[model samples]
Target: MTRTHVSLQQNFAGIVLTQGDPGYDDAREIFNAMIDRRPAVIAQCRTVEDVKAALAYGQREGLDIAVRSGGHSVAGASVIDGGLVVDLRLMNEVSVDTDARTATVAGGATWADVDRACQPHGLATVGGRVSSTGVAGLTLGGGSGWFERKFGLASDALISVDLVTADGREVTASAEENPDLFWALHGGGGNFGVATRFVFALQPLPVTAFALLLWLPETARTLLRTYRDMVDRGLPLDLGGGMAYLTGPPLPFVPDELQGRRLIGMIATYAGSEAEMRSAIAPLLALNPVASMIAELPYTEIQSALDDPPGFRNYWSAQHLAALSDEAIDVFIAQGEAMLVPSPSQHLILPWGGAVADHAENWPQPHRSAAWVVHPFGLWEDPADDDYVISWARNAVAGLQPYSTGAVYLNFIGNEGEDRIVSGFGRDNYDRLTRVKAEYDPANVFRLNHNIKPWTP
Candidate 1:
């Protein structure tokens, strides 16, 4: 190895992998198989000191640095070509304080880690729908999950965050300390610095009921209208989940005839007993689903139940809507019909007006106020169908432009462009975030994410 590489390994209290290193290939593999970056160095950080050492080394060596936690960035921002990756996978740790109703999670910890750690105490905060998603990445992008309707986004529950700044400074952002940075982190993504730790306020969630109901694709139009009407009439905060059109998986619960067929499905999670969950979704249940699975599962079980398998070529985009009118429902159903069947793709319509809207003004994500989000999640195995899947997802969003709020949730999308990034946070909030970015990361060292550029005259 080169003297510089040896020097970095000596200074870092963690594993360092070069191109030919034993674990280099596995270490560089991210969730999305489409990304094939070959970083010059991968520093698998084990402590805060390691993160600092790696960041300093990258900056001094004039190599681009990408901060990686769970490595779930759809755009593959966590890895870069011929750059340095400060990978935090080894730092996955979780400590729950039962008395304080809080969880202090290491930066690399996934939703599964958090959920499993908090499950025994019957406590949880909003997390990403996929259990494998990075806690820091999702929370920074305004966390969306099953419990979001009840407890708000995961950022709303954050008590503090420990970060390593672009200049190799150790700092903590909280309400009483570095409050501006804390506010910017709410939905600004990883533009400012590398988050090392997060303190999240937890809530009591002793019981969680989950129900997945499915129907033939032909019933989607009627089902979409009914779902929209139910949301319009006001559903309880305890109820959380979305309706989607997906290819039925080859699970035992699904009949053989429907295993690969596109079908309409509703997934509901209630922070209560099964009976209560059934009552909460009675309106739709009355419509007579062809297949159903309902149970009082542990919160952890519910969190990981629908974990999306990794190594799939993924392309996703979303549009937030102020309202879901009948015409919009028609448009959504049409998009669903056009989805690539027999694939893991989902044309989702999720409600967003519960706790999400109530705290809209508190953070940078003004799109939280939108009543609905139409997310076209495209996951396929073959690289040959890349263009078709990407076009379908893009077209799905374009079809609903007339009904959209001109805002978006950044986490639901890949790297569209700077305009879409600005739209994630409103123009005003984007301006504020740029100032924060300037203060902490003036060099724009951490520019791999949906970046907020450092401000300039």
Candidate 2:
């Protein structure tokens, strides 16, 4: 295990970047502006053998290791300070088997990449609304998206993943093989190892219709009420819906009349025939859109529509609630209308009862009790106004606590440490996950992400 004795250059067939290396800055950058950490080296790995070698080097030298796939981790967990980063962004390869309804994607692939390859054949796996998000991190965090109500979370559709463990071993975890590791990898953060590849079960890809977008400031109460009723009645398996408070941007998509304003947006998508898609959304279309951008676009374009935003500094803290109560609605609207920022920063609440709420066991994921996720998110440009955005979000969450289940999504969190991450899992689930962490990584080497610390020896 001598550091220099082993021929690392020969062992690793991928590129490595030390300090001052051309790719070091790009490798360290994450989506969250609040985080800035520099790692000693960045292993921009290509092959699985590269991942194995990087892990082995980190282990032998007692160096901290950070596993980065998309580099979009909100908590800045994908990069570390003075550590070794195994950057998987370069491993973008995919193969499809249409007959078996499955796709094996390289770990670094994005939602856009998956859709481009799969949508032509009218096949798809669970992908997020944001197109640029990595398939590995998002799916592993229990993905939610347009098709989530009909299909399941991305993790549930997983067949297997090729991972590099803490002990420098490459292994595959699937339902029928390595069952416990497979169970933990789904919705569990990167605890056991760095996932190098994913085998996902494909579902039918339907590009049916785009419903009207209704804009209303006075109808927040009615919209949430009606939305809840629709969910309770059990929506058609072909239908998917989400409602949010959106701040109008400068895009031409928003009419000049409504630019730079806040409006409640109710949007839906359906996978049936064109007529059925129209009928499924007839209830909302009746409201008469103040300004609408609904059209018949392919599912891939629809999913990636919001992929690029005029980049701005953002701060976010999120909580998943048992229900979206009237009081919660009021708090959201009040905070939303109080927007003092320049860029698109607004609160988003996505419901979760359809396929996600039916979980039967106490896995590491504690989002089971939550029916909706309230994201107090905002963005601004002036460094001085950063305080305003964070404070505004903090106060809103403080008031809405009574309705919340005290659970938070790991991916949406800002760069806080171990205690905050443990809180996100709640007391019981956090303890359970901690035990699992102890069983997998007792030395606490994998402590960068929304961490669950292994119990002290």
Candidate 3:
């Protein structure tokens, strides 16, 4: 072992994994199977002191540091080759306050951890559609989720965040403390510091409904139009979900003939009873779905139903639309038809107007003003299909450029370029976020993410 590695092992109060270590390979695995990186050290931290020591060690040795929570970064920013990774997975602890209607989640905790803890109390906060995503990563990147229309973005529900800064200082950001840092944390990504914990005000979730309705590709255009009309005619904020083009899973609810085939589908979540959901979505139901399933399940159960398993080659991109014009709908439908069949790709268009637009000015994600988000999520297994799948997602975004609002949701995309980063958070917000980066991480110690270079004025 190198002198620095030996020193870290001796001084660091965490499980320091080096090359050839027993759990090193497994510890390096992230949600994206495509990312193969070997960090010089993987510090599996179990306490805040361990995080501080790891940060100081990396800085002292000039090793690039990657802060990992659930390790769900599509770009694989959570792990770095020949560097140090502060793996916070061991710090996954959550405490829910039933009386205060709030949840305090450790940085490494996943949405599943948060939801399972809150479910028993019949309370929930906005979280990513898939439960495996990290609470800190998703929330800081302007979390978009199943109940965003009703609860606002996950960052919107954030009551406070505790973080360890680049210079080894522990701090907290909230409305009353470090307010500027708090504002930048919303949708700014992991550009400032290593978030250790987050506090969120939860909402009552007494009755929840989950539904998935499927139809053949031949019905794509028809169902899309009906779905668009349903959203336009004032769908309630309590109803959330989207339409997508995906390979039909072999679920019992899916027709035997349709399993493994490409299909157009709608997945819906309602913050109400199954009967109310049936009434609310009656218009789409009247169109005669080929295969479907609806259940009055617990909120936690439905939240995890769509969790994408790891070990798949993944590429994704998103475009925010000013409005879903019929012309844009045609472009979206045509792209869905051109997608790689029998793959796990999804050409999605989700409504974003209710609580999202309502609270747009509360944070820096200007794209929330958009009426819809077109996300083309590409997931396949073969490395040979990587180029094809990436091109498909890129072309999906290009096709709708004419209707795009010129802003994006960073979490839905991989590392496209700096221009796309600027486009994600408008140029102005990007400028402001840099100033915050300058304060907490002037040397840009945390540069693995959608990095914001420290601003000097």
Each prediction's Cα lDDT score? 0.91, 0.75, 0.91
Candidate rank order under TM-score: 1, 3, 2
lDDT tens readout by residue for model 2, 198-242: 999998875655553758678777776776666667667677657
lDDT of 3 by residue, 1-457 (tens): 6676777777556799989989999999998999999999999988898899999999998899999998889999999999999999888899999999999999999999999999999999999888999998999999999999988999999899999998989999999999999999999999888999999999999899999998888987788888888888999899999999988898998878899998989899999999999998898898888899999999889989988788998888999999888799899989998888898788898998988998787788899999999999888899999899899999999989999999999999999999999888888888998999999999999999988899998
Residue-wise C-alpha lDDT for candidate 1, range 1-457, written one tens digit per residue = 5678888999677999999889999999999999999999999999999999999899999999999988888999999999999999889999999999999999999999999999989899989888999998999999889988888998999999999998989999999999999999899888888899999999999988999999998888888888888888888889999999999888888899988998999988999999999998998899899889999999888888788777899999999999999899999988999888889988899998888988899999989999999999999999999999999999999999999999999988998999999999889999999999999999999998898899997
Q: Which stretches of candidate 2 lie over 4 Å from their true place?
A: 1-8, 211-216, 360-362, 415-420, 423-428
Question: Which residue pairs collide, candidate 2?
Answer: none
How well does candidate 3 score on lDDT at residue 456? Answer: 94
Per-model TM-score, in order, reads 0.99, 0.91, 0.99
| Candidate 1 off by > 4 Å | none
Backbone clash total for model 1 is 0
Poorly placed runs, candidate 3 (over 4 Å) = 1-3
